[model samples]
Target: MVTAPFNWRPHSRGRIADDGHGSAVGPQQAVDVEAARAARRRLVIDRSCRVPCLVLFCSAVVWLLAGTLLAMIASFKLHEPRFLADFAPLTFGRIRPAHLNVVAYGWAFNAALASLLWIKCRLAATPLRGGALVLAGAGLWNVGVLLGTLAILTGRGHSTAWLEFPVPAAAMLYGGFALVAIAAVLSLAARRVRRLYVSQWYLLGALLWFPWCFTVAFILLMPAPVGGVTESAIGGWYTRNLIGLWFSAVGVAIIYYLLPKLTGRPLYSHQLALLGFWALAVCYPWTGMRHLIAGPLPAWAITVSIAASVMLLIPLLAVTLNFHKTIRGRYRLVGPSPTLRFIVFAAVCYLLVGGQGVLLALRSVNEVFSLTHTIIGHAHLGMYGFFTMAMFGAMYYIIPRLTGREWASVGLIRIHFWCVGLGLALMVGVLTAGGIIQGLELNRAAAPLGHYIDEHGLSEGVGAFLSQLQVRGGAVDFLDVTRGTIPWLELRTLSGMMLLAGHIAFAVLVGLNVAGHSPPRPGPMLLSAAGRGRPLE
Candidate 1:
């Protein structure tokens, strides 16, 4: 019998076969583990290498389409609130948070869990029980999202943005998550194969990371963790922590899985990966305070936050260096492997987003950039640019492996990648431009000082000051302002409109194209099929 290259135990082996041997031992008194391992591994390999992965793939596409629609509607709202103003339930405010939640929780997290669950079973030599339960759990989550989206649009939103889903919807979501998590854990516990792998680290982390973050977010935000003025800071920290711990873990885990798969290599330095993981865990909670820079929060709070944010460079660099080194010389394989392309895109964005995050923490820049589209722009860089991209890569790689077939069509993958990538890139461009312009306007201290602003001129002092200054500067004074040149909010809004249009087109194309393709037949051993769909010729 063949043994796996990686050292591991198979989760369980058949109990009956050895009876034929007729040894001194009774039929069940003792069984050979190695024999059992082989049998269990074969069973898992045979079944999992079927339709389950395909189901996961289709589900991801559906959720992503949902997310894009939300993003597109929200983008329009940013520029023209009237687009859906007549429909209170479909207003940009409601749809926007819904879109973020759908993408982050629905599309990304679901895809991550599905991929990890499948991969974990394969690696651990375990088998997923009740694939039906997996499906039911996924279905329930989507249903909850539908209800939550509707609730938010109808003004049931708590206005917590990411956490806007009402109590019932939240409870439903938690139930679904619980079902899936329990299945995954049980699958691991029952796995016929016993050795854990690199991917399992991510799978395990994801299962744990989300519950921790989500529980905290709900405890703090939904119930109001504290009744005082300090609640906002806790809420902000909770939000950032969710993104940092849960969403961020999902994105990086995909990178860890796909990058190595594409190259047909082991990770260059497992040691470096450990460093990155540990550092992120230690640093993220504190970095949350950076969002509160110069707010009513204490000085030390902000100081420690800034310090940790700066130190975030460690994990960021660690991942970058690890991936860059491991994938070296495998660039040729990328064209052949959709997995490579998707992960490569994600890794690049990770570097860019991490750098942008640190820069935002600087007080001078925050003074100008905090309240405007700049913040949104940076947030998306991490959310879409890095997180979404990574999730996409995982889906591409996982789909074929799970389904035991090639993608429905490579053309579809390419279209999805470019549309989502370019769409988000455009989003960043417009939002960033708008943010810079608005910040520059705010920091137009040449008019005066000690001024505070929100994303819009919302507050009374800020509003009155902004109005008074407009009269003083007239239109001509706008040209000669200082602070690093980012675009103004007006311009940013226009740019967002354009990006929004692109994302809409991308979403439509993805939906239409995916719908057009028929499914493929299953096969064995799920060869990495590592490439964009072309051979070496």
Candidate 2:
């Protein structure tokens, strides 16, 4: 059956994902084919890993584009309410969060899962077992994502940031996962190799973390059972874990895989990798409290949380040192090979975000940083800069194996890398700068005035500046704005006529923040655009 399943390839481009004629290969050549199949199968797959990877890749790209479109709409809404005010469902409030969810859950995660499946198989040294079940699970998961995302678009979504899906959709997604878990367990147990490597540990940790995080968050925050602020606390807890337990786990897995692959040697410090893993798991749970610091939560909760957040430096330093140490003489590979380049980018981003997280946890820092775009900026650094970059590297590494061709063209890869990467870079810069100016103004208990406001407002003023900066080619200099916002608060007037920009920002932010109707007033929006509607803090 295993051998027969693979025969569907060769002449068909999409054959790996299908299964039909494979049941009829003659017995003689079949043995010869089987021998070679086993050889290639060592690379992983019963039917073929690439087939599922391709499908997943499509799903992810679509979601990302969808999310981007949503964001652009949201940006417009902020600046011109009447632009789409006629369509209540298309409001910035709705589309922004929806886009955020789609990208985070659908785009980034689906890509991660595609890569994770590849790594999981390689680490286990096993061909996939329940191909049917996995296909079903993945399909159902997509269905759930589509329905849930549409729900958000139609304004039927529950108001949870990372956990926005209503019960039925969430159940479908989780239910699909249960099948995959079953398949994974069966496949692992049946593996030809049993080295019990550390990468597998990270993958397993991620697998476990998803359900645990989702379940806990659901019980505490789902509409049918919204437990008030307690649920809110739990929901916050889920977001942190999604980073620590889910995305972080996959990130660690990528590091473990890519480090050895790029250097052409086993990991230089397996012991260090293991140490990082356990430390993260043990410490991550406590770190969520840092987000709630001075947020009407208990003092002990915030203090311990802050302590845990600060302690993350241990993993950050250890992982950074390990990655660089391994890459000491291989820096050239980063430029020559897209895979290595992305891996290097993601690793550095992880360190930057991790270190920044520790800093933000500080009482002085969080005091000024909380409830502003500064926090949002930090979140994106972790999400896009760290996690998304790793995911892209993973895709570059995995696609050829699945596509059975060298990506049709390196030009496409380069195009995507530049467009997507540059876009994100621009976004991080503008937001960071706007955040800093806003933070400073906010912390001072007042907004900035004439000259400074004109130079840095994110609405018509800042938006115009950014638009002009785009023409000037010196935009990245503004990234300091994003980072600086962490040290203070910022707010301004209330004319209520918010200036909107491109839709991309709105969708992404909304998806990121959809945890709970986003606090209605959002403790964090802005002074330049959205601020026109509400009084300043």
Candidate 3:
């Protein structure tokens, strides 16, 4: 006797029962019809944001290629300082910093922005209101990156590690970021959905935190300092928190969004997620002091930092358990979903990197290893292994939807994964070993510092030996200890080459997919068990 709503349509099987006068759709059929319409509306909202996202991604991939080349040059220059020493711009000192800045600002930040914008729109269930603003913001960001990179190469760098952009360039970058952040804020405010998802919390947190960290770091490191030791303390704080608050926040947001969707399950525990978020916010900001453990900061500051670093385990374990439970029986999805595979890999790296941070913060360990290449290995683990991999996974999932086509070649995807994975492992493993050798040798009281310079006479070998001994740490036989790092450095260079090739393949694949080379398909472009066949999801 009751009729379904006016917009209701019968699902398959013509299940609607007819009253004596007219056909009436069932209640379940009406619900299904509404759900289907909602999904289509969401798709439309996402498509509306596609153009700006594409511009950001395209620019990001170009920067990725450039950064990998610079990394290769810097890695090789470590062992062979004169390899390109003739060119001032390509020298190890200049090229190394340039590589770091380009990858972080140009590639990683831009990539994160693209992913953030798309995901935010999806979760808010709203179309982007200011598409032109997003595109213009991306354009200005690229301009700032270009100007900063050129300044660094031209020897006008700020001399800070990640904040090396000159003042003018930094101003430009800050302005660009403000515009992008505003777009995110407006989109979130105008959300049609009432409840905020976990991913939205992370996206908002990162967008807010990055500018705060950047501005604080700039004030502390750029202009005149309060004191020499205070400057160092602030710089260390900014550097450490930048990785945790900005990069890790964005990376984890992507994982949260993709994992549930990929596994066809909701998050395991909302309370656990809330716990993780609050714990990280309260604990991660102060943990930066751990980086200055052996430096001239107050003991209380160092102790607080170390404690915060160790306490991070609470959130780390909480998030790790939440994700594991969500993906409990869906391991097979890793094969069919590149997004799941990369997110899982990034999750594992998060555990490794966080545990490593706790270990490296202890005074007993810090005394010997603080100055060694171990620090370099750890930095890469967080930046490249964890954050970058998460972004790559997000891109794989997002691009196909935006382009309305599958990937160009499944084979290239496998190649890119293995290349980046194996290369990062090799580089990290080798550097860790070399750092241990250098640390143990440098702490040996049997050999004095003066003896190294007196015997070796400031030649290239002697310079390397003394440099390691003086800062990074060395042993009784300075030459022997310094020589131990050479093989590792060479291996690192080889790994960098692998990374370069992998990035090139990724760029080409992205370009092809965007250009509509791949035939349109309903399901995802996924590799099979053997990692060669195309298996639809």
TM-score of each: 0.78, 0.76, 0.87
Each prediction's whole-model lDDT (CA): 0.64, 0.64, 0.79
Q: Write the per-residue lDDT of candidate 2 for residues 1-537, one digit (tens) a residue.
A: 233334333432211111111221223455575546554664446235655656666677668777766766665555455777878788777887787888887888778777777767765556676767767878888898988888887888887678888888888888877877777777667755445556678788888888888887886677457656676678778889988888978887787676655544335565776778788878888887677877878788889989999888887887787777766765654655666666777888888889888988999878866876667768777887788878877765665555433333344445555655665555555556556555554544222323334566646654443344224232232334443442321211011011112123322322322322222332222212422222111
Pairs of residues clashing in candidate 3: 441-474, 441-475, 442-474
Find the candidate with the highest TM-score and give its number: 3
Model 1, position 371: C-alpha lDDT score: 74
Error of 1 at 295 (Å): 1.6
The runs of at least 3 residues in candidate 2 whose Cα sits more than 4 Å from the true structure, single-residue gaps closed, are 1-39, 43-46, 223-226, 445-537
Q: Which numbered prediction scores highest in lDDT against the true structure?
A: 3
Task: For model 2, state the Cα shift of residue 167 in Å.
Answer: 1.0
Q: Point out where model 3 deviates above 4 Å.
A: 1-31, 223-227, 445-477, 529-537
What are the runs in model 1 whose C-alpha is more than 4 Å off?
1-3, 6-46, 49-57, 191-195, 445-537
